[model samples]
Target chain A: MEKTNIRTNKNFNKVSDIIESLTINTNPDSVAVLEEIGTNSSIDEVRELTSRALVKRNEHDSLQVVISNRGKGINDMSTIVAMSTINELLSLENKEEAMRVLENTISSEGFDEEVKENARSVKALMALS
Target chain B: MSAIEKVNQLSHRIFNTSKNEQSTSRTSNPFAASNFQKNILTEDVFESSKSKEANKVNFTGNLSASSKRIYSVFVGSINDIGSRISSGIESIKAFGSRMKEGIVNTCVNTWNKIHEIGNKEESLNGTKELLGRDITTFFVNKREREISKMANMNPHMEVKSIFKDALQALEADMVQVA
Candidate 1:
């Protein structure tokens, strides 16, 4: 068991370094690339970390990717990753942009009911905390 | 002449020896006995030195006034040594009390530290403010905030370069994992 942990630690550290690099990229297109790779990534941990990175960006474009994209961010089938993204949204220093995106997702008829519901819940949490 | 007479004679010799010690030395007197002969002459071997020092009358069977003065001086020296030993015992008792004081002070300090550790009011305050986030989340958030600041400061930075940098980072990760 200890040996397995040691082997996985190296891979975990490698992922962390790459994730840090993703957050370091400053261009607007990085958000789209992040949404594409983050939402579609097979690994739940990657999706979770990437979703958080997007929310931390706090830009309208980055906020929309995590808040409205299908099967990504708040819409992730993985409850754990979706919750992680919600927690990040709630924790943002400036909630104005994220709240606007959520209001759009909730009011617009284009989003799935599930995604809108997640947005409403996140909004409620933001109001509470 | 007899056993008792010999003892009396020896004491008489010692008494006169002390009285006229300036002029009549024991070694110079032809009749005075050696320490070895004194031992042989005494009934018990251990009796020689101590019993020899014990006061005996002069040839007249009465102690001289000068002899009493010498005995008093010897008793005074013994009393002085005994008092010094008693003072040493008193000092040891003082040291024991000082040691006890040091132990009490250490116990008090440890008790104060324990109370400081048990204080929970600050933790409760932090919980109310949501300042008690997990350490891993705190570090990740701080890193993302840095990225946000960089993006805001360098508006001219290209989206193409950002993708290129991210692709390079992923490729490096794949190589390492492999």
Candidate 2:
């Protein structure tokens, strides 16, 4: 188990380096790397970056689907990431599902108080809009 | 029975009762009476050191790794934008008064876009407005100084315009992920 942990850490580090390099180079390949990390990596920051990068690259539709699918079980930090990603969705009609996810996160005990609070606030903003 | 007989019987019972064959076992401390003790007298064997790998704690879980990577990339991207802005300003500085009007127009337009995208109420009541103002002021002052250094009296309008331009560029260049 310990060895597995060590190996996993190494893999994360390697992937992280690759992603950073792609981003730094502004290579189109970075989008694929980001997408992979966003979907597969358990890390929220990595996912956030992937989502943001995807949005910037005009991959909004796919990003929305990804967020809808994987944006569950959000804790406080993941809530922030999820909210930020959701905000970038661009399409108001499509945002309802993502917003619902945030609403669920607000009620979820796994998230920290701040995340829940932010989720609540984002939900409120949605209600107002 | 008579008292004297009772007394005699009690004495006999007390004195002649058979002792239990099983005796209570005695225990000894191993440290106190070990037969094969080491001759060397040092506390090094008892002293402990933490492993390096153990000390290097891995931030495992969702928030830990994700937040860290996101933060790093975010900061890096910001720096990249800042450098780009600084370089633009430097080039404008070289162009002197000729670029002043263009710079201000650009900054003001950028500010308007930022205001539009961000909630108007928040832009007015929030830090964004203050930040936008400060940024505008900074570029205005910077451009004014550079123009003065060239011994050129750039019109006040031109200075304001250029400052606005720079501020707009700054806002546009800043990745609005949220």
Candidate 3:
């Protein structure tokens, strides 16, 4: 039991550190790393945390990673995680930046329809609020 | 139809899924998005429940004749539910692409489709609804329900309050832009 508890705590701290660095680290490659690993993790909890961290950073680059990626961020396979990400996006203090990213995602012809449709959902919710 | 096939048929109706048809990609038909759901996502509800055997009900107590008949009917229905579910699970697994995110995506598509059809009110006349609530208003109410569910699952998250504010802000007057 003690071993399991320590292992769990260590994992939790590791995830927290990742999220903290993703938000505070100003390097462009930092966000790139987050997009590649954090969002792409098969675990729903990891993907959800990455999404929240990106939304919390409130930057165009971070927001674009979550909004445009397939099977990640708002496009998560788990409803709870996806909804959680959407909730975080809506809770941002400066909603305009997220709105800008979502708008571009919607109008861009490059994205898959699934991505665009998901973006459209976020836009509708954002528009309402 | 075979009993399993019958059960599969009933499962299709219960899950609101296409019968034996692989769900077309959202790109093919924008409206086919909400195709995945809860039962499809689970690993094996029947097998898990069977192994544990915790959910089995005991109806062995002495009872009057009429009461026993009612109990028999209840037991039959419960057994039917279990069988129908097992068959449905198999059929859904056959459909492939059992992504949980598809559940939310499908909801968005259907919700948007209703509003889109309501806006036209021409060529199709699909705006007709039963309860006198406009399509947009109906959609808001549904989202409100969803927000409540999400909130319960993750009370730490702000999912519920954000959606509540969105619904209240719209006041059901705002139609979703398709």
The per-prediction tally of clashing pairs is 0, 13, 3
lDDT by residue for model 2 (B33-106), tens? 22235432222233223433544574443457678789889989999999999999988876875577688779
Residue B77's lDDT in candidate 2: 95
- Runs of candidate 2 with Cα error greater than 4 angstroms are A1-32, A72-77, A90-129, B1-178
Off by over 4 Å in 3: A1-8, B1-178
DockQ of 2: 0.01
In model 2 chain B, where is the ten-residue run with the lowest total lDDT?
B21-30
Q: Relative to the true structure, how large is the alpha-carbon lDDT of every model?
A: 0.68, 0.50, 0.67
TM-score of chain A of each: 0.87, 0.39, 0.87
| Candidate 2 structure quality by residue, lDDT tens digits, A1-129 | 232343334333333333333333333444444554444444454555455545444433443333334343122146656665546544355555656666666677775576666566656766766
Query: By TM-score, how accurate is candidate 2?
Result: 0.22
User: In model 3 chain B, where is the ten-residue run with the lowest total lDDT?
Assistant: B169-178
Q: Please name the candidate that would achieve the greatest TM-score relative to the true structure.
A: 1
Positional deviation of A25 in candidate 2, in angstroms? Answer: 8.9
DockQ of each: 0.05, 0.01, 0.01
DockQ of 3: 0.01
